[model samples]
Target: MRSSRARALEATINRLLAGGPKFFVKDHRAVSASGDPLRYPARTQRLDYEAEVAVVIGKGGRDIKSDDFTSHVWGYTLFNDWSVRDNVSFGPDFAYSKNFDTSATIGPWIVVNEGIDPQDIPIECRVNGELRQSGNTHSMVHSFAALGEHLSRDTTLWPGDLIASGTPKGTAVDSSRQETDGSFPDTLFVKPGDVVEVSSTLIGTIRNEVVKPTG
Candidate 1:
């Protein structure tokens, strides 16, 4: 997404060479991202929060041209791709780390794309009212249109599909807190009672409190 564009491209290039993107399908029936507690299925050591800008697809198409991206886009919204990072130990699959119920959240509302300039828009995330991420859409490596083009190459993007742009620097696992051993300190993650908010003037704010999971 636009969020990762600000970082050095070396990491991006290497990631592409590794296997392509780290994507996993979400179980729509189990999604309860907002107005619900952001909880953990188990006692995950690193319950990471990914604040992002989600692109709302209005029309469906396959092999879309980037220049025609605007015609297919419907609107924009906020997204949080919560992750149970340490859970990757099960087998390194996103299904293990990302597909849990309530692991992700989507908007309080949508801002339709009528007279909007998607780029250069401001975005940020905060925990307990403390700012942790601050970046603009200008840094996005790929425009929403470009993402639409690349993503729809193999499959059709139907109406209601959401594409979450990447999270920005200062994310819980961002390099700022990386240890010499290449591990993020335990303090960087979220815990019960933590209030996380992702927002932007172009879109709107979405806040949630972390709580213990229920059966």
Candidate 2:
């Protein structure tokens, strides 16, 4: 029943536009972004990147029934959920930490959900060009239908809205466990200037650079 800040921010942007905008704003779309590709606000460290197909709502509804989910869905595109992991852990609301300037990057293109099956897409994430996470959409514990219905239980959903199918099992910081070698444990984490890439066979890749905070 809680409101999604991501949705709120999007609505505000659309309201300010002159024409009836037909697109959802994406935060970031590349792992190797260059030439001012839009960045989030300052005060962040350990920016983790994720590869995902962002679902864009075409039709708006409230308390949508599970059986009618298809009617509300519009299209899908790629997204990178750039996580300022450190701040998110310390903040009161995920909005300040997760929904920053360009923290949610989406799309190279929009694929109509009516024509594509969401359950079979191949999604993967790579850091510095190396494969780190891979999984099929079928692996999700919560299906698109379920999520839509659950979210609309007591809230309204609007067109151009976004619903990120949560990342696969291997996405979080402790994606890999037991990477140990006695006294020192060899671990991998995204650092500033590192190229993080996330791709879906259905949508290609969304890439970005991990820049260190400057004071």
Candidate 3:
């Protein structure tokens, strides 16, 4: 749980926080194909995978109550919010670091069922068949209902809009940096020829292969 990069980010956020929490919107261009090859950016030194669950909206509404979250949900699916670690710096440029084409991977398909519980499902990430990250929704710091209500407070969540739940802690950087010195493991980060898969019992799996950018 104690990551040098995370600690550095925490320190940076603390200095910028005047009072409460903050959220930033990402451009739609960041989305990528779920089964397509992940093109490694020529400029980044590190491309990391963040295994997460994605919630798809079924209806459009504002100021939606937490209890009404279920009615608004369309389904659940897998997502990998890829990160370019080297592109990050003090006071981070999230847009520049995370908005690359094919950066946000989603799907395999959506599971639309009212009986599904988002709070206790198992989630994991594997690189080349080796488990890299593992955790359950029960450990999520924020509940899906709370997130839905908070997001709809000032903005409308339309049908088809995807809301990605935050990722669990076993990222490539986290494992390498926490277990060894603060250095990143060359084998951990996604590089050309690597296959990354994010899976969950509730939704299924999303697999992608890393490849050099042809353009």
Q: Candidates' TM-scores?
A: 0.84, 0.71, 0.85
**Regarding TM-score, does 2 or 3 come out ahead?**
3
Error of 1 at 57 (Å): 0.8
For candidate 2, the per-residue lDDT at 135 reads: 83
**Sliding window of 10 residues with minimal summed lDDT for model 3:** 16-25
lDDT of each: 0.77, 0.64, 0.81
Kindly report the root-mean-square deviation of model 3 from the true structure over all alpha carbons.
Answer: 3.6
**lDDT winner:** 3
RMSD of each: 4.6, 11.2, 3.6
Please write out the lDDT profile of model 2 over residues 1-215, one tens digit for every residue. 54564575457456634342222224433232322243533654345566666677889999998789878888887777766555343235554545565576666667884477877778898877888888877865567777788777788988987777767645545453433451212245566567777787777677767554453
Q: lDDT score of model 1?
A: 0.77
lDDT at 136 for candidate 2?
Answer: 77
Task: Give the per-residue lDDT digits (tens) of candidate 1, residues 1-215.
Answer: 54443464466656644643445666675455566787765758778887788888999999999899878889888888888777364254756677777877888788994587777568898999989888877776666777778889989999999887777777776543556786668787888889999898888888889888777
- Could you tell me which residue pairs clash in candidate 3? none
